[model samples]
Target: MRLKNKTLATWLTFFGGPLGLHRFYLRGFGDLMGWLLPIPTALGLYGIERVQTYGQDDLWSWLLIPMLGFAIAACALMAIIYGLMTPEKWNARFNPGADPEALPGRTNWFTVVGIAVALMVGTAVLMASLAFSFQRYFEYQIEEARKISQ
Candidate 1:
Protein backbone atom coordinates (compact mmCIF):
# COMPACT_ATOMS: atom_id res chain seq x y z
CA MET A 1 0.00 0.00 0.00
CA ARG A 2 0.97 3.60 -0.38
CA LEU A 3 -0.05 7.07 0.73
CA LYS A 4 0.13 9.61 -2.02
CA ASN A 5 -1.12 13.16 -2.39
CA LYS A 6 -2.50 13.16 1.13
CA THR A 7 0.05 15.56 2.61
CA LEU A 8 -0.37 13.80 5.91
CA ALA A 9 3.11 14.83 6.97
CA THR A 10 2.46 18.52 6.41
CA TRP A 11 -0.77 18.61 8.35
CA LEU A 12 0.80 16.69 11.21
CA THR A 13 3.70 19.12 11.35
CA PHE A 14 1.44 22.12 11.72
CA PHE A 15 -0.91 20.60 14.25
CA GLY A 16 1.55 18.52 16.29
CA GLY A 17 5.10 19.69 15.67
CA PRO A 18 6.46 18.97 19.09
CA LEU A 19 6.16 15.25 18.22
CA GLY A 20 8.20 15.70 14.99
CA LEU A 21 6.06 13.91 12.38
CA HIS A 22 7.73 15.89 9.61
CA ARG A 23 11.09 14.52 10.58
CA PHE A 24 9.77 10.96 10.76
CA TYR A 25 8.32 11.11 7.26
CA LEU A 26 11.69 12.16 5.95
CA ARG A 27 13.45 8.99 7.32
CA GLY A 28 14.96 7.14 10.29
CA PHE A 29 17.97 7.84 12.60
CA GLY A 30 17.45 11.57 12.33
CA ASP A 31 13.69 11.21 12.69
CA LEU A 32 14.11 9.51 16.04
CA MET A 33 16.53 12.16 17.22
CA GLY A 34 14.24 14.95 16.13
CA TRP A 35 11.34 13.35 17.99
CA LEU A 36 13.33 13.52 21.23
CA LEU A 37 14.34 17.15 20.96
CA PRO A 38 11.47 19.19 22.38
CA ILE A 39 10.57 17.51 25.64
CA PRO A 40 14.08 17.59 27.06
CA THR A 41 14.59 21.17 26.01
CA ALA A 42 11.49 22.29 27.90
CA LEU A 43 11.86 19.98 30.89
CA GLY A 44 15.59 20.49 31.39
CA LEU A 45 15.17 24.24 31.29
CA TYR A 46 12.36 24.13 33.86
CA GLY A 47 14.19 21.66 36.10
CA ILE A 48 17.32 23.77 36.20
CA GLU A 49 15.30 26.68 37.43
CA ARG A 50 13.70 24.57 40.15
CA VAL A 51 17.10 23.50 41.39
CA GLN A 52 18.33 27.07 41.44
CA THR A 53 15.31 28.42 43.25
CA TYR A 54 14.36 25.62 45.63
CA GLY A 55 17.61 23.78 46.45
CA GLN A 56 16.18 20.23 46.87
CA ASP A 57 13.15 18.15 47.87
CA ASP A 58 11.57 14.67 47.74
CA LEU A 59 8.12 15.07 46.17
CA TRP A 60 7.86 18.08 43.92
CA SER A 61 7.51 21.85 44.07
CA TRP A 62 4.77 24.05 42.70
CA LEU A 63 7.14 25.37 40.05
CA LEU A 64 8.19 21.84 39.04
CA ILE A 65 4.57 20.72 38.77
CA PRO A 66 4.03 22.95 35.78
CA MET A 67 6.91 21.23 34.00
CA LEU A 68 5.12 17.89 34.29
CA GLY A 69 1.94 19.46 32.96
CA PHE A 70 3.81 20.87 30.00
CA ALA A 71 5.37 17.46 29.33
CA ILE A 72 1.92 15.90 29.21
CA ALA A 73 0.75 18.53 26.78
CA ALA A 74 3.81 18.00 24.65
CA CYS A 75 3.23 14.25 24.60
CA ALA A 76 -0.35 14.75 23.47
CA LEU A 77 0.80 17.03 20.71
CA MET A 78 3.36 14.47 19.57
CA ALA A 79 0.87 11.64 19.58
CA ILE A 80 -1.49 13.59 17.39
CA ILE A 81 1.28 14.44 14.99
CA TYR A 82 2.52 10.85 14.76
CA GLY A 83 -0.98 9.50 14.32
CA LEU A 84 -1.87 11.91 11.55
CA MET A 85 1.37 11.32 9.71
CA THR A 86 0.78 7.57 9.63
CA PRO A 87 -1.43 6.25 6.85
CA GLU A 88 -4.60 4.61 8.10
CA LYS A 89 -4.29 2.11 5.29
CA TRP A 90 -1.55 1.72 2.74
CA ASN A 91 -3.86 1.05 -0.17
CA ALA A 92 -2.45 -0.15 -3.49
CA ARG A 93 -3.51 3.19 -4.95
CA PHE A 94 -0.75 4.87 -2.97
CA ASN A 95 2.07 2.40 -3.68
CA PRO A 96 5.29 3.74 -5.16
CA GLY A 97 6.11 3.48 -8.85
CA ALA A 98 9.32 3.16 -10.90
CA ASP A 99 9.58 6.94 -11.12
CA PRO A 100 12.49 6.71 -8.67
CA GLU A 101 11.70 9.93 -6.87
CA ALA A 102 8.17 8.69 -6.33
CA LEU A 103 9.37 5.93 -4.05
CA PRO A 104 11.58 6.81 -1.09
CA GLY A 105 11.71 3.17 0.10
CA ARG A 106 10.00 1.29 2.89
CA THR A 107 10.13 1.46 6.68
CA ASN A 108 11.27 -1.73 8.43
CA TRP A 109 10.14 -2.93 11.83
CA PHE A 110 13.46 -1.91 13.39
CA THR A 111 13.00 1.64 12.15
CA VAL A 112 9.59 1.84 13.71
CA VAL A 113 10.89 0.40 16.96
CA GLY A 114 13.73 2.88 17.03
CA ILE A 115 11.39 5.80 16.68
CA ALA A 116 9.12 4.38 19.39
CA VAL A 117 12.04 3.93 21.75
CA ALA A 118 13.22 7.43 21.14
CA LEU A 119 9.80 8.77 21.95
CA MET A 120 9.73 6.76 25.17
CA VAL A 121 13.14 8.00 26.25
CA GLY A 122 12.14 11.58 25.66
CA THR A 123 9.07 11.13 27.83
CA ALA A 124 11.10 9.48 30.55
CA VAL A 125 13.57 12.33 30.63
CA LEU A 126 10.80 14.87 30.99
CA MET A 127 9.23 12.89 33.84
CA ALA A 128 12.54 12.54 35.68
CA SER A 129 13.30 16.22 35.36
CA LEU A 130 9.92 17.08 36.78
CA ALA A 131 10.51 14.76 39.71
CA PHE A 132 13.93 16.16 40.48
CA SER A 133 12.64 19.69 40.26
CA PHE A 134 10.02 18.91 42.88
CA GLN A 135 12.61 17.34 45.10
CA ARG A 136 14.67 20.47 44.93
CA TYR A 137 11.71 22.55 46.02
CA PHE A 138 11.07 20.40 49.06
CA GLU A 139 14.68 20.61 50.18
CA TYR A 140 14.55 24.34 49.98
CA GLN A 141 11.38 24.44 52.04
CA ILE A 142 12.91 22.34 54.78
CA GLU A 143 16.04 24.48 54.88
CA GLU A 144 13.98 27.62 55.07
CA ALA A 145 11.99 26.23 57.97
CA ARG A 146 15.14 25.32 59.86
CA LYS A 147 16.53 28.79 59.41
CA ILE A 148 13.30 30.31 60.69
CA SER A 149 13.53 28.22 63.91
CA GLN A 150 17.13 29.22 64.46
Candidate 2:
Protein backbone atom coordinates (compact mmCIF):
# COMPACT_ATOMS: atom_id res chain seq x y z
CA MET A 1 0.00 0.00 0.00
CA ARG A 2 1.27 3.44 -0.91
CA LEU A 3 1.64 5.82 2.01
CA LYS A 4 -0.46 8.96 1.66
CA ASN A 5 0.63 12.20 3.23
CA LYS A 6 -2.03 13.69 5.42
CA THR A 7 -0.91 17.23 4.70
CA LEU A 8 -1.10 16.69 0.97
CA ALA A 9 -4.52 15.12 1.30
CA THR A 10 -5.83 18.04 3.31
CA TRP A 11 -4.43 20.59 0.89
CA LEU A 12 -5.70 18.78 -2.18
CA THR A 13 -9.12 18.39 -0.68
CA PHE A 14 -9.19 22.06 0.17
CA PHE A 15 -8.26 23.06 -3.37
CA GLY A 16 -9.85 20.31 -5.41
CA GLY A 17 -12.18 18.37 -3.16
CA PRO A 18 -15.16 18.84 -5.43
CA LEU A 19 -13.11 17.76 -8.41
CA GLY A 20 -12.09 14.64 -6.46
CA LEU A 21 -8.35 15.30 -6.60
CA HIS A 22 -7.93 14.41 -2.92
CA ARG A 23 -10.08 11.34 -3.34
CA PHE A 24 -7.97 10.29 -6.30
CA TYR A 25 -4.80 10.79 -4.30
CA LEU A 26 -6.06 8.63 -1.43
CA ARG A 27 -8.03 5.98 -3.35
CA GLY A 28 -6.71 6.09 -6.93
CA PHE A 29 -9.03 5.06 -9.78
CA GLY A 30 -11.50 3.49 -7.42
CA ASP A 31 -12.61 7.01 -6.44
CA LEU A 32 -15.72 7.13 -8.55
CA MET A 33 -16.91 10.53 -7.36
CA GLY A 34 -13.56 12.02 -8.18
CA TRP A 35 -14.01 11.02 -11.80
CA LEU A 36 -17.74 11.74 -11.90
CA LEU A 37 -17.86 15.25 -10.38
CA PRO A 38 -16.55 16.90 -13.52
CA ILE A 39 -19.65 15.87 -15.43
CA PRO A 40 -22.01 18.02 -13.40
CA THR A 41 -19.45 20.76 -13.10
CA ALA A 42 -19.09 20.99 -16.85
CA LEU A 43 -22.79 20.72 -17.32
CA GLY A 44 -23.27 23.47 -14.76
CA LEU A 45 -20.92 25.71 -16.66
CA TYR A 46 -22.80 25.01 -19.83
CA GLY A 47 -26.06 25.75 -18.11
CA ILE A 48 -24.70 29.04 -16.79
CA GLU A 49 -23.53 30.03 -20.25
CA ARG A 50 -26.95 29.22 -21.64
CA VAL A 51 -28.62 31.32 -19.00
CA GLN A 52 -26.33 34.22 -19.74
CA THR A 53 -27.15 34.03 -23.44
CA TYR A 54 -30.86 33.13 -23.32
CA GLY A 55 -32.07 34.93 -20.19
CA GLN A 56 -33.48 33.84 -16.78
CA ASP A 57 -36.73 32.57 -18.24
CA ASP A 58 -34.83 29.39 -18.85
CA LEU A 59 -35.24 28.02 -15.34
CA TRP A 60 -33.54 24.76 -16.16
CA SER A 61 -30.45 26.63 -17.25
CA TRP A 62 -30.04 28.01 -13.74
CA LEU A 63 -29.45 24.50 -12.43
CA LEU A 64 -25.74 25.15 -12.67
CA ILE A 65 -25.89 27.69 -9.82
CA PRO A 66 -27.18 25.11 -7.33
CA MET A 67 -24.74 22.51 -8.60
CA LEU A 68 -21.82 24.88 -8.09
CA GLY A 69 -23.12 25.84 -4.63
CA PHE A 70 -23.23 22.17 -3.72
CA ALA A 71 -19.71 21.65 -5.00
CA ILE A 72 -18.39 24.57 -2.97
CA ALA A 73 -20.13 23.32 0.18
CA ALA A 74 -18.79 19.80 -0.35
CA CYS A 75 -15.24 21.02 -0.84
CA ALA A 76 -15.39 23.18 2.26
CA LEU A 77 -16.72 20.28 4.32
CA MET A 78 -14.03 17.91 3.03
CA ALA A 79 -11.28 20.42 3.76
CA ILE A 80 -12.52 20.78 7.34
CA ILE A 81 -12.79 17.02 7.76
CA TYR A 82 -9.32 16.34 6.38
CA GLY A 83 -7.67 19.20 8.25
CA LEU A 84 -9.19 18.16 11.58
CA MET A 85 -8.24 14.50 11.26
CA THR A 86 -5.46 13.56 13.66
CA PRO A 87 -2.16 12.36 12.27
CA GLU A 88 -2.49 9.07 14.11
CA LYS A 89 -5.90 8.41 12.64
CA TRP A 90 -4.64 9.44 9.24
CA ASN A 91 -1.71 7.08 9.41
CA ALA A 92 -3.84 4.27 10.77
CA ARG A 93 -6.31 4.63 7.94
CA PHE A 94 -4.03 5.54 5.03
CA ASN A 95 -0.65 4.23 6.10
CA PRO A 96 -1.36 1.09 8.06
CA GLY A 97 2.16 -0.33 8.31
CA ALA A 98 3.95 2.96 8.88
CA ASP A 99 5.59 3.81 12.18
CA PRO A 100 3.31 6.12 14.11
CA GLU A 101 6.31 7.71 15.75
CA ALA A 102 7.65 8.73 12.36
CA LEU A 103 4.54 10.69 11.54
CA PRO A 104 4.35 14.44 12.14
CA GLY A 105 2.65 15.79 15.25
CA ARG A 106 -0.98 16.90 15.57
CA THR A 107 -0.64 20.49 14.31
CA ASN A 108 1.22 21.40 11.12
CA TRP A 109 1.52 24.00 8.37
CA PHE A 110 -0.66 22.06 5.98
CA THR A 111 -3.55 21.87 8.39
CA VAL A 112 -3.33 25.59 8.95
CA VAL A 113 -3.27 26.28 5.26
CA GLY A 114 -6.11 23.87 4.56
CA ILE A 115 -8.28 25.36 7.25
CA ALA A 116 -7.55 28.86 5.99
CA VAL A 117 -8.39 27.92 2.45
CA ALA A 118 -11.61 26.27 3.56
CA LEU A 119 -12.65 29.37 5.47
CA MET A 120 -11.87 31.68 2.58
CA VAL A 121 -13.75 29.54 0.10
CA GLY A 122 -16.70 29.11 2.40
CA THR A 123 -16.92 32.84 2.99
CA ALA A 124 -16.70 33.60 -0.70
CA VAL A 125 -19.47 31.14 -1.49
CA LEU A 126 -21.69 32.56 1.19
CA MET A 127 -21.12 36.09 -0.02
CA ALA A 128 -21.78 35.11 -3.61
CA SER A 129 -25.04 33.40 -2.65
CA LEU A 130 -26.14 36.47 -0.76
CA ALA A 131 -25.25 38.72 -3.66
CA PHE A 132 -27.13 36.55 -6.11
CA SER A 133 -30.24 36.47 -3.94
CA PHE A 134 -30.11 40.22 -3.44
CA GLN A 135 -29.74 40.77 -7.14
CA ARG A 136 -32.74 38.60 -7.86
CA TYR A 137 -34.83 40.31 -5.20
CA PHE A 138 -33.98 43.77 -6.47
CA GLU A 139 -34.70 42.73 -10.02
CA TYR A 140 -38.12 41.47 -8.97
CA GLN A 141 -38.78 44.74 -7.16
CA ILE A 142 -37.82 46.74 -10.20
CA GLU A 143 -40.11 44.65 -12.38
CA GLU A 144 -42.98 45.17 -9.95
CA ALA A 145 -42.33 48.91 -9.90
CA ARG A 146 -42.39 49.00 -13.69
CA LYS A 147 -45.67 47.08 -13.75
CA ILE A 148 -47.20 49.50 -11.25
CA SER A 149 -46.00 52.56 -13.21
CA GLN A 150 -47.45 51.19 -16.47
Per-prediction TM-score: 0.40, 0.75
lDDT of 1 by residue, 51-89 (tens): 578754424344545554455446444543443333433
TM-score of 2: 0.75
Q: Point to the candidate with the largest lDDT.
A: 2
In model 2, state the lDDT of residue 30.
89
Pairs that collide in candidate 1 are 1-90, 2-94, 56-135, 56-136, 56-139, 57-135, 57-136, 57-139, 60-134, 61-134
lDDT of 1: 0.49
Q: After superposition, how far is residue 94 of candidate 1 from its true place, in Å?
A: 15
Question: Model 2 off-target regions past 4 Å?
Answer: 104-106, 130-150
What are the Cα lDDT values of the candidates? 0.49, 0.72
Best by TM-score: 2
